[model samples]
Target: TYIRHDSKDQFTGLLDKNGVEIYEGDIVKDADSGSYGAVVWSNDKHWGYLFDTRPDYGWSHPVKGFQRNYLEVTGNIHETLLEADNAKT
Candidate 1:
């Protein structure tokens, strides 16, 4: 059987502090700043990978601003929503 991955989920060629691969849609946390956000591609003038802290408002920071070791992959947007909802209760 062939399992096809989503084309939107592209690897960012960087690893988290725990050696976890950081990919698009993967929620990550900054170990030092304690800020969490989703990894996404910036198609605007920046044109690179960025950490979108506010997906609803489009607030984000460039991945190049910090060291890869400062990032920690917590979960992914695809599977973490259920977990997040469960925590709200």
Candidate 2:
């Protein structure tokens, strides 16, 4: 798992187990332009799959796109993000 430190030394990138960056910075805001589903974030403390830019809340949602494969792709990202968060504190 790789952790991206922001200018402030905070967790910036949450990569997957395969070393693919899933959540970077604020997931709700820092999503990639293409393949938006490649990443996602937790809102209401619930993991939301990355769908696309939402016109209503300015955020995307994952539904019918998340499965075991998704977890494999985001394992590293999750661990790294957690580590970064711990380091910050």
Candidate 3:
């Protein structure tokens, strides 16, 4: 998912393939998958999405930026699960 800031510097939703919403008012910036989730700014309100399953969120978290899948959205967390499975084995 790619993001672009408007003239006022307010972020806007460009496109979303992951079927996730990141912002409420406007989107400002976003992080790469490695960073975990992306950050969005909306009229002073900010939020983000969790790339992987975390304690904060059951599996994912709610954010203020538009979520994407093809471009730069974060992937689901699998390392933890993999570790657990490996341990069981």
Candidate 4:
């Protein structure tokens, strides 16, 4: 299988509260609200780092500094969103 040569090849340097590795495009949900967002690297912080998503609340925040114990890897963005959309119908 051919992989994209994007910078996503770099390590996200993060993991879920369950020790699951966090990666770009991986969808994450807050254990409390069940709010989900895709894992993405933000340039807003200059050099940049992997941040947990919470579109319902706002944008992404550093996983390192946030409450990692409250985060979970539900699925990746594509399949997870597709599943949600399909369920709505």
Q: Give the number of the best model, judged by TM-score.
A: 1
**Model 4 CA RMSD to the hidden true structure, in angstroms:** 6.4
Estimate TM-scores for all models. Answer: 0.66, 0.29, 0.23, 0.57
Relative to the true structure, candidate 1 has a C-alpha RMSD (angstroms) of 5.5
Model 3, C-alpha of 35: deviation from truth (Å): 1.8
**Per-residue lDDT of model 1, residues 1-89, tens digit only:** 11123677888777777777777888777787887877777755332334445557666666763567788777778767766899999
Superposed Cα deviation of residue 77, candidate 3 (Å): 3.4
Quantify all predictions' global Cα lDDT against the true fold.
Answer: 0.68, 0.41, 0.39, 0.61
List residue ranges in candidate 1 displaced over 4 A. 1-8, 44-56, 82-89
For model 1, where is the 10-residue window of minimal lDDT?
A: 44-53
Total clashes in model 3, counting residue pairs 3 or more apart in sequence or in different chains: 11
Pick by lDDT: which candidate is best? 1
Candidates arranged by lDDT, highest first: 1, 4, 2, 3
Candidate 4 residue lDDT tens string, 6-83:
454444667678887666777677787767766676656421223344445556655653666887766665566677
Give one digit per residue, the lDDT tens place, for model 2 in 8-35.
Answer: 3233244333445444332322223323
Estimate the TM-score for candidate 2. Answer: 0.29
lDDT of 2 at 75: 30
C-alpha RMSD for every candidate:
5.5, 10.0, 11.9, 6.4
